[model samples]
Target chain A: MTSPPPPSGHIARNARLGIVLFVVYVIIYAGFVALAAFAPSVMAREIAGVNVAIVYGLALIVLALVLAIVYMLLCRDDADRAEDVAR
Target chain B: MTYHASSIAVAVFVFFVGIVLGISFYLGSRARSAKGYFAAHGQIGWFVNGVAFAGDYLSAASFLGICGMIAFYGYDGFLYSIGYLAGWIVALFVIAEPIKRLGKYTFADALNAKFNSRGIQVAAAISTLVVSVFYLIPQMVGAGALCTPLLGLPHWAGVVIVGVVVLMIVVTAGMVSTTWVQFIKGSLLVIFCAILTVAILARGFRVTADRASIKPVAATQPSDIPFGGQVVSIGNGDNAVGASTGPLGPVQFLQKINDVRVVQWTAKADAAHPGTTLYTPVEKQAREYMLPGGSSTFKGVRSPKLTDKLDFISLMIALFAGTASLPHILIRYYTVKDAVSARKSTVVGIASIGFFYILTLFLGLGAMTSGRLDPTPAGSNMAAPLLAKTFGELPFALISAIAFTTVLGTVSGLIMAASGAVAHDLMENVFKHHPNENAKVGAAKWTALCVGIVAMALGTLFKDFNVTFLVGWAFNVAASANLPALVMLLFWKRTTKSGITAAIWVGMLSSLAWLLLSGPAYVNIYKLDATRAIAPFSQPGLVTIPLGFIVLVIVSLMTREHAKPH
Candidate 1:
């Protein structure tokens, strides 16, 4: 019962953009998870006395940051409007 | 028993807490209004709020637990960082704007905006308290851990000190003080960790293996019948030490520190027998850490069983989903001016948090090969701090202080959150009692004190558990109880007040149920001589997260006709 008012086409459009971004996130993350499973040998490497998981783990952090930035872009308008109302 | 560096660290930490509490006392004067106490009069800037998000989010778990995990467990520990960062996606996409638009103060405000139903209030309030307590446990535990090296106190004293300090922080100014504390700590944490990382890279890895001789234990008992045979008394003195007397007798344990070799050890079973020792070379330290392209590697790329896959998958799900659900983190959005700033701040947070996580991978890997690891499970948490100490005692002292501040900032934020729930959601909203913001602020202050005390008690109670492992349980509960209701409320049209309330109850109960019934909690908490557990696995995210969504959907469907558009 407490859902916010529906967005104009703009909000829907933004949500759609979000869906696209989520799909991209899924693909990238899935690929990594799969690699961690099926071809660990090919993926594994030693750098600075640390193992492959550490390297890939670093990449995941970068991925999350980039995705977060992407998310901000996708939802900027709806978020702006919501902020205006909140103020 | 004492050193100047450790003393200085404790003094600095105490000084920092004093400054924060002073600000809270000052803010307490102005927080007479509900808006002033709960939302900072809705006046905080996006940047401050964003930094506060970091301050609130990077609790003891993120700083101490993750770092310690990496320090001891190698790459397996860093997987947590990946999971935590992934959760921001849910915050950005699903929860951010809706939460800002719908309600005024607590999460209950958002959930009950549509129906004005008391049920929603009670359920959401209870969930908030439960999740807050769970989250509180790790922070208190972390506080205790920090105190040992910093103040030369037992773990329980640290918990008590933090609880008292946090109570003061919450009682004095509510969100105003909490926000600034988080902002300062967040900036300090990021900058210091960056500096530490740079130091690690510049110094690089080195071999520092040390060996000690073990006292051989006599296999036979001493008796008059034995001639020219050895009688094994407790062997006591080592170098300049005193004699030891114990049930196991005087058995000397030897620890070899081989800094050059990053030996990842696993206990393997003998094919023909039940118990044995099998040592294999996981990888060389130099080759593992310093790949030609600059990356580290782990052996178990593809875990064989469904349980392995689920463990990995469930951890990821919790980390990604848990961020948006955390009570303290969500409150930061309220402190900001508008949704645009919230988005922008989140972007900044992502950048800072992301960068630090990358550094943790290096930090963890560095500790793994430093030969400073505490081989005993009980001592694993010391790996990171000890690694810093290995570089220099001052750095260790500094990092330990920062880590303690990390706990302080987060615990204060959480107390602020819980106090808001009691003062704003239940007292103000449910009871229909109007307290001027000042009166409400007073209520919030008292609530913070009570909650802080409870948290201290729980922290002392659960002191033996690993701080990192305890945090995972907190995440699991938050993700289950909070995330499903939040996402469905924002996106699904058919979601009714009844549906939201049901989701909160079911999601919370089921996850807590699964966790309590699972092997880890049973063995760890219950102290029962039980058999292997009923569930396929212990962690509940794989089961309970989906269950939350399912309950929300089904309840929404059942109550669709009753649902009204807000």
Candidate 2:
């Protein structure tokens, strides 16, 4: 259990955002790996020209890049707003 | 199959090496102070630092090992890229900003910042050194592996060349030159791989006329040969079609691999004749190779055995956890300015790294059908460069040279992290030696020198090994040793100095011990019976990582109030 995540400030908000985004990554990555392990037939099935395994793997990679960008945009904007308020 | 030396490869390799050395010596002048030397005075822009992150993180293993594995094993090799790139998610969301805010020079600095504990300093320092050295072996070995293919030199010569060049780079200009080198190297490596991937898509699958009639092994030898695999007729069939897909889209390119027949080799040396290399040529179904678990190493994904599944899961966990915890990667955050910049840079790294890893799949598959594999099974590390040679000698030289720079970028970061541990963590924090900035900088350079020498020496010692798994072991050690402590320190308030210290040492030693005593080490390194191994499984992360957390939580609970020195 996490220790009552810092009294709801910007840091806390960013941390919460990060944690949620991290979960998104976990879901995508874990789902892909689990599918690979438990469902080879599904993985081997061709979607378009690529196998489900390849599509999912490449998707997970793209999803990570997207997540990183999303996190950066969210936090960077928040950081700027917080700075403006401080000023 | 022995690799022949190419003059073109040698010339191009030398040119790249010269440019890197020139850059290092030139940048050496700027990094006089401790901050400049260790962290580039925190002046590097986020974008460059991020590319350097790609440069630093994408070690020889990623470029050579992953590509080689994919070339040999198919979908299983791409799994490493997935696992490796996945680790960056942890780095980006969790560690990047916090590490930038926490530490100054090294991972130990941030770790000890909260408690100012010598125990934390010593533990973190030792962990950095151990993890760095463990990581260096494969990189150096990759250096050697490339040499045999590019220059026809013995393995040790490549090892020495890389070691000496990297030492010069680190000692001359610690992080400044390293970052720029990595940025340029990282950028070029990505672009080149992208080019190669595009080339692969263009020059797509060419099915052999008699694609179905290849045997996995020509003959089964007595189970005594240690390191030889010779496939009789991988594909003697005439070209049914030329190796060109005529501008197929990426998806179409991957999909087409399932319809082509490829020859993949498996090398196994038996106990009776370890020197006798027995090679089996296996005709792989496109569907099989294009799908996951193409190699025996990743068999756990589909295996019925409980231990096998656990092993795969454990390896994935380690890869997921290891990236944020790696000392060199952690230290890189300190080279950037602020948390936002660090986050942005991490995004850039993720993008670059993700794109490259994606390319590795096509490059590997392209190599699978290239029919240019070194007849010797042991030379898988040269798969990508040799694949490049399929197009032309110039691209081969370029890929090989860039691969060397890949080693340099990574090795320099590792050495920088290692030397920082010695000077910043051990000498300054643990010993409480408040030396002036210049003296500390000087000590760090000397430490870099020593660490470089040590790395170079270690590079020579661990030659001719499958670096992919060795890198996995390094990741396990990093994840077990550093990830738990770092993550807990960030998230948990109850984490005491004692708890952190105990967790690190226990995690480090226990995991290391477990790895050394594991089944693979017994069979592979020691050349002994696998049953003689003490550890039940090869990977120690599933056990040691939790043990680290458990020990931390318990110790933290016990000494919640007793915040004493001892």
Candidate 3:
């Protein structure tokens, strides 16, 4: 049979962290969608030789990766601390 | 514009399929147990599972559909790339660890973990099947698209070949073989596309005199410029062709294209010839070509209509919310040992997928400026393969073979999810059957075969729709049906069994109903006037997704007494 889930405290901590990060991402993503829908001219303006649409799109992809790394690192620390407490 | 089956392409395709089959057969003996068949015994390494995630997630829609869209429509396709990758953020952050902890075989297992209610089991399993079938259409459509250029076969033949081959792969070994297949193809796809991107950068934009060779036709008169013909004119004059900007930087490539005018085609009813349509080239400024709304699919972004704008937002929202809720992707977390492995693998998936999406921009734009685009509506799916052909026949063969594998990897994952829903969730859990291990495996294999046949039929039926657009509808259904229950179950303390059950049904049915009555479905599926569509917008997420959440909360409150204390 499969083992039980991790301690509720640990799971709860991770859930809190995850939800916070998810909200941040949702806001950023919403901003992109809003601009594309409402302000086409803003997205049309060129930045660094490419338009803002391309730049912002690339940024969203990059930011997701960066945040993923951050979440992973922070979770690892939490796991390590939990281990210490258990010991 | 015409594609002939090359000896080299056929050989490479055969070699790729042979190797993939060989792996499945070798793994078949090891997957005799139900656990082995369904979840690879939960022993997959985090890294392999991670890349397998990339392999499974980057469907034919990502490789062929988006590239084709960008080739024809510019930045709008990349918008799909961005939305698709961002959905993984939801996957990585909210769903990964919890799903890994709860589920054993299928997504249904996770949803039914706390309650063990037959209602949840049935609802979630049906959702999995519905979502899987919807998702399979795009992969099957993609398979048909690839077969034409790769084997010089008709679209139906391609769909059939993929159906038969994917069935063999799934029925033989299940998740063991599927994971490895995804890993292999995922790595190869990324590596090859990176190579293709570098080649694109090196070649840059060349001012060709092909347009000058063609005699200009009046707007009222029929033109001889066939579909897929290059009509780009550089410099000041209408027919003027300037010097090549050799070996440009990525940024410089976009800047250079800003000075060039691209000819986009629009099809209208023929005035002179009855029962035939005429495709006329309309030259567009660089800004119009490079910006968002260049294609008909995303033209709503630049439109004044509120419903049009809402359609665009709904599509993006569905894509963002959908990734976390996909049955196939959720099941991948079960392939790994524990929640930590699930987390680690999701990070790897995000990194690989994000990087590949970034490459899609370069690859799509490369096809756009390659002077080799097939401008016909049907030709958009062939953009990437044709772009590779411009490089040489060998690159074309390799990319086509890899594109075929992209279809196989995703289709196998979807079928696995479906079969698990049938055998593990529906028959065993919901129906309360205590089947032996061998019997369960047998049931799953049978389910795989049946699903494969259904996918093949649908693939051929929906051959004309863009694979990416079809995938968007699948996303809309998946997100609306699956996301609300999943999120509430994980986060809310008062989520009851009835809430989960009611949410899945409400979400799944509402989204499906909305889609069948939407504008796109009216024109494409029903063959009726688009103006007669009942749904206000083409995409259903904005209405249906929230409806899912609200229904769940109200139902949970009403059924509060049914909740068992933890």
- The candidates' DockQ values read 0.42, 0.46, 0.49
TM-scores of the candidates in the order shown: 0.84, 0.92, 0.95
Compute the lDDT for candidate 2. 0.81
Interface RMSD of each: 7.9, 4.5, 4.4
How far residue B417's Cα lies from its native spot in candidate 1, in Å, is 1.4
Clashing pairs in 3: B228-B375
- Candidate 2 — which residues are off by over 4 angstroms? A1-8, A76-87, B208-245, B266-278, B564-566
Ranking by TM-score: 3, 2, 1
Tens-place lDDT digits, model 1, residues B1-566: 12223776777787778777788888887776677778887789887887778888888887777766765444556667777777776677667766876778888888777788887898888888888889999899888877876788887998998888877777677788888888888998888888776666555443332112122222222121111101111122222222222111101110111123444433343455443333232334332332211211122234566564565566566767788898888888788766666667787777777777776765665566554554333345555666677678777877887888888899988888888888888887788888775677778788888888899999988877778778888888889998888888777777777778888899899888888887667677888633566655667887888888888888888888877654
TM-score of 1: 0.84
Model 3 lDDT per residue over A4-84, tens place:
344466667777888889999999999999999999899989887778888899999999999998898877445644543
Name the best candidate (by lDDT): 3
Q: Comparing candidate 1 with candidate 2, which one achieves the higher TM-score?
A: 2
Residue range B392-465, candidate 3, lDDT tens digits:
99999999999999999999999999999999999999788979999999999999999999999999999889
Identify the CAPRI category of the predicted complex in candidate 1: acceptable
By TM-score, the best candidate is 3
